[model samples]
Target chain A: MSESNEEKKDEIQLIFGDKRLDGRRFDELRNIKIEAGILKRADGSCYLEMGKNIVVAAVYGPREVHPRHLQNPSKAVIRYRYNMAPFSVEERKRPGPDRRSVEISKVSREALEAVIMKELFPRSGIDIFVEVLQADAGSRTACLNAASVALVDAGVPMKGMITSVAVAKADGVMVLDPMKEEDNYGEADIPFAFLIRGGKIESIALLQMDGRVTKDELREAFKLAKKGAMEIYKLQKEAIMKKYISESVENG
Target chain B: MRPIVLPGDLVATNPKVAGFGTYVENGKVYSKILGLLDKTETSVRIIPLKGRYIPSVGDVVIGIVREVSANGWNVDIYSPYQAFLPLSENPEFKPNKKPNEVLSIGDAIIAKVLNIDPKMKVTLTMKDKVCRSIRFGRIVFINPARVPRVIGKKGSMVKLLKSELGIQIIVGQNGLIWISGDRKKVSIGEEAIYVIEEEAHTDGLTDRITEFIKRRKSDVGIE
Candidate 1:
């Protein structure tokens, strides 16, 4: 069963990676689509779709902090959770939060908090929940991008938008926004976040590479990541603006 | 034509100064200055203004009756506002008709926004075509703000969800969703709802949803 499952996965990869069949470039990302303001129970929510990866994120509050221990008097707290559903991937993930997810949640919160003005909400905390409905290569990056858009849609103030992209070394060649196939068999995967306005790297969360790349290759990867981040930024801006325009019309 | 401000463009009245202009608001490529239409000490209204489907007086909305009263039904508008659909609003509602017969708890209906009083009371009427009863579907709740997202860009998302899952999905602007299909389709519909709810905070959500459906379809085959 395991062997056959592996073979099935391989077959799936071959089908998905048939760029000639799909007419896509190696470095090009799958079609990116975004929808903002998607959760009713939450303050802000958004849905992000990138190829075969589906991620939804909800932002609840700059409201009062719960349990007290997590609260900070000097600044607002930011809580982030990155979770994958049991059936999100081909191999089902366990329901409860895992160590890797928890770690990713912490790093993601830190990265996002750097862009948010915690001083504005003092003592309050913003809770961000990201749910992965499907998994491809760069779920984390997708989550970050979606969370930023949701925050903006919720009218949360920030210095600038936070956008992320993944760079990986696949088949001994560096690629931008590597797909599921590239990520499974690829050597390196680096997901980095950037501030949209100034185009500065805000944080690098998960950087793993089976093999080392030259200094020039690393720089080139960073450059590609930045480019991808900008594109994501454009999509985020468009989503927010679309909401605003429609909202204004409704108000009128 | 005035310079169109793309979604992320930074524009100021004075070209020489940097970082002073109003940031372009959502979905608008360019907004003309066209002189200020109205100005207050703290707020101003500009031209080429955009529109949204916010709840307003007389607007029709789909709602679920969450609670029932002798005189009226309490409707969950799926918005920031709650609505009361009075018995008088239902023309066909016989006095002898049990509230369940007219509209039961969890029954979805189209309701018209009658009056949103200063006290925040939302009065609704079931006197419109869209205000009639909804049949054979499950009601789902979403964030009011995310309604557009679920609908997608020009109705693409809803279309895709309906086609892929083979479900009839009706999305109310107030965040109420009614979905009907076969058992498998209904389960898929529920999963799609959760998908929308979970990923509502992200951009590029449609691609993810499509990918999710595709992956899930393959998974079921594998099982």
Candidate 2:
């Protein structure tokens, strides 16, 4: 029996007896902490930590646009940049916007643009910067989470709030909030962002997939990711309220 | 009063009208910003907690002259849009005279927002009795959203500050407050204004500020 157990330990064993390598259920998410309005100079800002990933986002504008020609005549334009710190990863990553970051920045900006009331600030621009201070996995989703909170903190009017999460498949089982190791060895990764209103998801603002999965597997992953996102949405709301509520309580 | 509301929170059901900081969707009024909820008999409004100043007609603002154009002066009102103070709106305007002679760059003036067109072009005028250029005074900056609180209900808070401190105060809608008095008195007034800005959301703010100012005056031997 001991010999059989030793043989079962494969080269990369990500699960054991219905539990992921980290002893989390397939549907369970990693620990998350979010704080809003952390930066003073930025119009709005947020600091977020999900699992081992740490991200900070800041928002500026609804202010005058530069270059004189980029101003949108009827609505505000969004300028988004997603960056990773040089010391964030194990292998020292180079500074500045790479191709992957550029693509992520474009998609993330579009996702937030769907919910913002851009027409309110015509001939102006709103800039959002997301900086990843640490990288585990699902950093794009983490960046989106921080950006949404920062927008609200800046008091930029919006049609609704947004929440995001990632689904990972390791050892043929879909999981929520995948760690760095799982992402490296996982079979598939799917990240999603949902527009939330009235305590319900109004629609999907973003959806991107990597690697291959069966149709049924994708549907199952969507369900798991939505459930995880709702939990994150509650935390996001709480983080924003905490700032004002604590002050009121101190004085009231 | 209800709890503070975030964007997309349902504020009222079947409201007849939605006021500022709120919007109507599908016959329901929803808050559009993070703010305190306010409901009237017929409509709903959300008082925004923080935001940049958006120019509206009739609002008196304190602006700095950034450029002296041919026909008008470009004024930085500390808003997203730059305002134009035309030479025609100047009470001292003369025919064929350069605009810079009237008000050169770097001069600060108190003007009224005369017009905001469809494209958000803000126009300012200095023809009102209260409008004038500031030569010397201290300008205190605070969040624009808290300006109403600083003025208090029906200008009572401002009245208290003015009488207690014996200072001339001009509260701008754009959050630039002009205070002029003896050096020590102006500093005390600036401190009091910052206190009001910080505690704007609290109850009985007027009484607390009164006590604070009195204490500060005695501590500094203002008599």
Candidate 3:
């Protein structure tokens, strides 16, 4: 390799190594902002700005599933396409489904399906499309959280509010809502989603760790995830109510 | 201390009693102990937790047409369902002419919900006075949930956006917005919409929007 190429690789590795960010303690989540019902064309849509990461989601359906093969007889099928726009990252991601996108899409669909009352629309499907405008480390979790809020914004009947958080092991400590830097050098990573109303874990998408944790460490991680989810739930509720009440006034 | 339970979860019979405990069943972790409800229960009733717009009958939704149909136009309602505006609903409309002349495919319009079928087919009518085409203004899209914050407590937000920008603005719950006035005022109105969308969850949004308008007005030397 050329000296310049070697230097670039070294720089990338250095940024991902042994450096804590701006004294942000482990288990601390960056500030999150969510706006629901942002798209006029989709049935329900939301925009999520989490620190520097931006994600937009549009939900459609509970309508007829087009392909005869994917149709389910008993309950509504949940289909999700978690995509990153070509301009979303430092290097543009190639458009279309790659392995990472497909995996994230599958896990996200499972997470959301846990809270959605699929029985409500038997023989149909709810289509959720998440478009990442900007991506840092925890895009998957952000997409999950944004898609849940968008689903609610669309008024799709879900059993409860679904919120997701990412936990990572940094310097042998578990932190909730790890930022982009923390994720790269982290020893282990776990992303989880829960139903806000009952606190039931709807899904656990990522659980890769270089080192094993004690049972207590895992429990603490779960606690932190729940706390983060609760905070997101408040924002989601506020966004929904603010729209509903104002629209009511306009109609009145 | 006893564990707190959120609504809409099931609890197990011999549930492990601990705060923030997780139980494994069929390869899934039930995060809260309370979610392990009795399996034999006849009906599991999860509360309808409020989050955002739930499409209902008679809702006035503002949308853009994505496609046209012989019977009606297929409008994107920004919901899980697509709305159909039948030509019959537009008594004055004549078919075979340019859809744009009567109702262009991309034209933003506000219409009322006539029926929501079991199939999630949304039927809309544009016969109402407010349901007609939006003209002499620019339409903006915002999160439907932020409409209240944009409008303020009692028409305060809307009133403020209008007076400060010197424009006429109408907000639709379906996330369609129309702003009409001077060019500068129209741009200011659009900025206000952006601010509302960005900072809707934050407190003091009204002040923020007002300040934005003031900054734009002063920047334009209109004081």
Across B34-63, the per-residue lDDT of candidate 2 in tens digits comes to 887767788788778877899999999999
Query: What tens-digit string does per-residue lDDT give for candidate 3 at B1-223?
Result: 1222233343443333312323434533233211112232332222122223446777777788888766778888775456788888875587666555677678677788989776566799988876776656788877665676677788898998888877877777666677888888788789878888766545566777888888988887676
Error of 1 at B137 (Å): 36
Candidate 3, overall lDDT? 0.68
The global Cα lDDT (0 to 1) of model 1 is 0.68
* Position B79, candidate 1: lDDT: 48
Docking tier of model 1: it is: incorrect
Query: Which candidate has the highest TM-score of all?
Result: 2
lDDT, candidate 2, A1-252, per-residue tens: 011222233447777888888999888989999999999999999999999999999999789999779998899999999999999999999999999999999999999999999999889899999999999999999999999999999999998898999998777778888998779877789999999887788899999999888888899999998999999999999999998774444332
Q: What is the DockQ of each candidate?
A: 0.02, 0.56, 0.09
Using lDDT, rank the candidates from best to worst.
2, 3, 1
Q: What is the lDDT of residue B116 in candidate 1?
A: 72
- Where is model 2 more than 4 Å wrong at Cα? A1-11, A246-252, B95-97
**TM-scores for every predicted model:** 0.52, 0.95, 0.53
Mark the 10 consecutive residues where model 1 chain A has the least summed lDDT. Answer: A1-10
User: Looking at candidate 2, what is the lDDT of residue B182?
Assistant: 86
Q: What pairs collide in candidate 2? A: none
